[model samples]
Target: MEKTNTVITIGRQFGSAGREIGYKVAKDLGIKLYDKEMLDRAAKESGICQELFETHDEKPTNSFLYSLVMDTYSLGYSSGSYTDMPINHKVFLAQFDAIKKIADEGPCILVGRCADYALEEYDNVLSVFIHADLNARIRRIARIYDLTDAKAKDMINKTDKKRSSYYNYYTNKRWGDAVSYDVSLNSSLLGIDGTAEAIKRLVEIKENNNNKKL
Candidate 1:
C-alpha cells in the first residue's frame, strides 16, 4: 500500500500490549516508533536533563500551577522565572514540543505522552486507544514482569492512574474515553499482531478517504 503522510498516536492502558502493537505497526509500515526515545529527543531539544523527563514521565501535577506556567511560557520566560517554574511543567512542555517536532519529521508511530493531544490540530493524525480486560492485563503484566498476580495488579493500577492523571491534566479530554480517540481496541481480543494489523487497516481506510476528499 502507498503510504500517506500520516502520524499515529497510541494511548494505551497499562499492560495492554499497546507498546508491542505500536512497534509492530511501525515495523509493518516501515516507520519509526517513538516511546521512551521521545523523552531523549525532548530532553536534547529542550536543553533539559534526561533524568527529569524520566522522573516526571506520565505524572500529573497541580492544574492551576500548570496553567500558570503555560501562561508564563506564552508571555516569555525570564531567566530567573523560568528557573523557578515547576519541573513537571518544564518536562511537559519539552515533551509537547518534541512530539510536534517528531510529527513534522514525517510518518511515525508515537506511543503515549499525550501525542494525540499534542497533535490535535494536525490534519493527518490518527489517534488510537488500546485497552484490555482487567484479567487479561493482570496476566500480561504478571507474565512479562515475573510478578505475582497481586503485585502485577497493583502495578497496573498505579501505572494506569499516573497515565490517566497525566493525560487528563494535560489535555481537555478524559483519558481512555471512546470519544477522545479515532478508535479504541481491546488488545486481548485480537492479540498484539492482530491489533497492529487492525490499526494498519484503519490507517489505510482513513488515508483513502482523505485522498478522495482531496
Candidate 2:
C-alpha cells in the first residue's frame, strides 16, 4: 500500500464484501476503518442513542424535512435551524458530521453512511462504489447465512433497495451510479482480495497524475 493523505470512502452493494475490502484497505495502508464505529462516534458526539442509529442504519425515513437537513449534514451548517427537527434528520446529520470529523483527523477508510457525500468538499478523498452481479451476490449471501438461493436473493434485493434509498434520499448523487464515484468496481470480476488490491492500486494512481488538480 502506498502512503498518502487520501481518505477512502466505499459505497457498496449487499453481499459485495465492501466492508471486508475496507478492512483490507485500512490494514494495507495502516489506517483506521470506520463502519459501525462511526455510528458510535456520532451517537456520543450528538448525545443521541447508539440504538437509534443502529435501528435507522441505512434505512430511509418517510419524512423529508429539508428545512433542517442542510444545517450541516452540517456538510455546511448553522445551529439554529438544526434544533427541533425530526429525529431522522438529526441522526443523518450527526452521522454526516461524524464523517467530516473523522476525515479531518487523517487518512482512513469510511464504509457507507454517505461518507463520500459528507466529505465531497474535502480534498484528498477517493470515493469508490463496489458491486457484484446478482447471481454472485445471491450465492455469497446464501453461503454466509445458510439460506436457500431464493431466500438469499430476496434478502439481497431488500438490503440493496434500502441502501439505495437511504443513499439517494440523503445525497444528491444516485446510488450505484458509476458517474457518482471516482472508481466503480465489480467485486465478482476480481473477487474480494483482488478487489482490495485493485483499490490499493487506485490509491497509488490517484496519488499520481491524479491532478484534476484533485
Candidate 3:
C-alpha cells in the first residue's frame, strides 16, 4: 500500500512487543519511527538538557509538582515562569511541542510520550494501543531482560503503572482504555510481525476513507 500523510501513535504494555511492531510498521511504510529519538529532538528544540527528558520520560510526578507546572504554563513562558517551573513540566512541554513539530513535518510512527494526545487535533493521526496476556507479557519480558519470571512480572507491573499514571495525568484520558484510542490489538494473538501487518491494513483503510471525504 502507498503511504499516506498519517502519523501513527502507539501505546503499549511493557512487554507487548509494541515497540517492535512499530519498527516493523515504519519500515514497511518507509517512514521514520520516533521513540527515544523524540527526547533528543525535544531537548534540542526546547533548549532543555537532554538528561532531564530522559529522567522524567513517561514517569508520573506528584500532585504538587503537577500544580506548579500547570500554573506556570497558565501564566505563560516568561523568564520567571520558565525558571520557576519544575523540571518535569518543562520536559513534558518540550516533548509535547516536539511531537507536534515532528507530526507537522511528515508522516511517521511515534511510540508513547503521549503523541496521540499531542496530535489529537490532526485528522491524519491514528492512535493505537497494544496489549497482551499477562502470562505472555511475563514470558516475553523474562526472555528479553534475562530475568526470572517473578522479576519480570514485577517489572511489567511497575512499568505499566508508571505509564498509566503518566498518560492519565497528562492527557486526562485513561491509559489502556479502548475508548481512548482508535483501535486496540493483542500482540500475543498475531505476534509482532503479524500485528504490524494488521496495523498497515488498518492504516490503508483509514486512508481510503479519508480520501473519500476529500
Candidate 4:
C-alpha cells in the first residue's frame, strides 16, 4: 500500500448518523468523502453492474452456504448441483478491490463495508465505530427516512445484523467491539456535528505528528 497522510474508516450502525459525521469530518479536513461514491467507482473500474454490487453490499451470506461460497470464490465456480454463483458476490469482490484501489489513490473517509478491517495493517489508518442508543437510532431513522417507529426499529435491527455478520466473517473480530476501533463514539450522546469535531481533532493530532516526523 502506498503511503497516505491519513485514512479514516468509519463503521457505523444504521441510523446512528455515522455517515453524516464522516461526511462532516472529511469536509472539515478537506479530504475526499467516499461512501456510495466508492461503490460507483468500483463498478466503473471493475466493469461490474452497480445494482448487483448494491445487492451484496454489507449483506451476510447464509452460514449453510459457507462452503459453497468459499468454494465458488476460490474455484471461480460452484462444484455441486447448485446454480452458478450469483453475480452479486463477484461484484462485491470487485468492489473490495475497488475499495483497496481507492485507498491507494489517496487519503479519504470510507463508510461501511468493513473498510476498517480492510486496511487494518496500514500504519496511517484510523478505524472508528459510531453507535447510538436504540431509541435514538430509531427516532433518527424514522425522521430521516419517513419510516414508522416500528418499521424503523426493524430496519435498524436487520441492517445491523447483516453488518455485524459480514464484518465478523471477514475480519474475525466482533462487530462494534470497542477494542476493534481506534475510537468509538456514542452519537446519541455527542450528536452528529459534535462527533465530527472530535474525529477532526484526532485527525489533526495524527497529521501533526506525521508532518513533524517528515
lDDT by residue (tens digit), candidate 1, 1-214? 5665799999999999999999989988989999999999999999999999999999877677677767767677777786777788888888999999999999999999999999999989999999999999999999999999999999999999999999987788999999999999999998998899899999999998998999
- Rate residue 85 of model 3 by lDDT: 76
Lowest lDDT 10-residue stretch of candidate 2: 63-72
List the pairs of residues colliding in candidate 4: none
Cα TM-score per model: 0.92, 0.90, 0.94, 0.85
How far out, in Å, is residue 11 in model 2? Answer: 0.4
Clashes of 3: 0
Sorted by lDDT (best first), the order is 3, 1, 2, 4
Runs of candidate 2 with Cα error greater than 4 angstroms are 63-78, 210-214
Displacement of the residue 42 alpha carbon in candidate 4, Å: 1.7
- lDDT (C-alpha, whole model) for all candidates: 0.92, 0.89, 0.93, 0.82
Evaluate residue 92 in candidate 2 and report its C-alpha lDDT on the 0 to 100 scale.
Answer: 89
Rank the models by TM-score, top first: 3, 1, 2, 4
lDDT (C-alpha) at residue 159 in model 3: 100
Error of 4 at 210 (Å): 4.3
Give the higher-TM-score candidate: 2 or 4. Answer: 2
**Local distance difference test, candidate 4:** 0.82
User: What residue runs in model 3 are displaced by over 4 Å at the alpha carbon?
Assistant: 63-65, 68-80
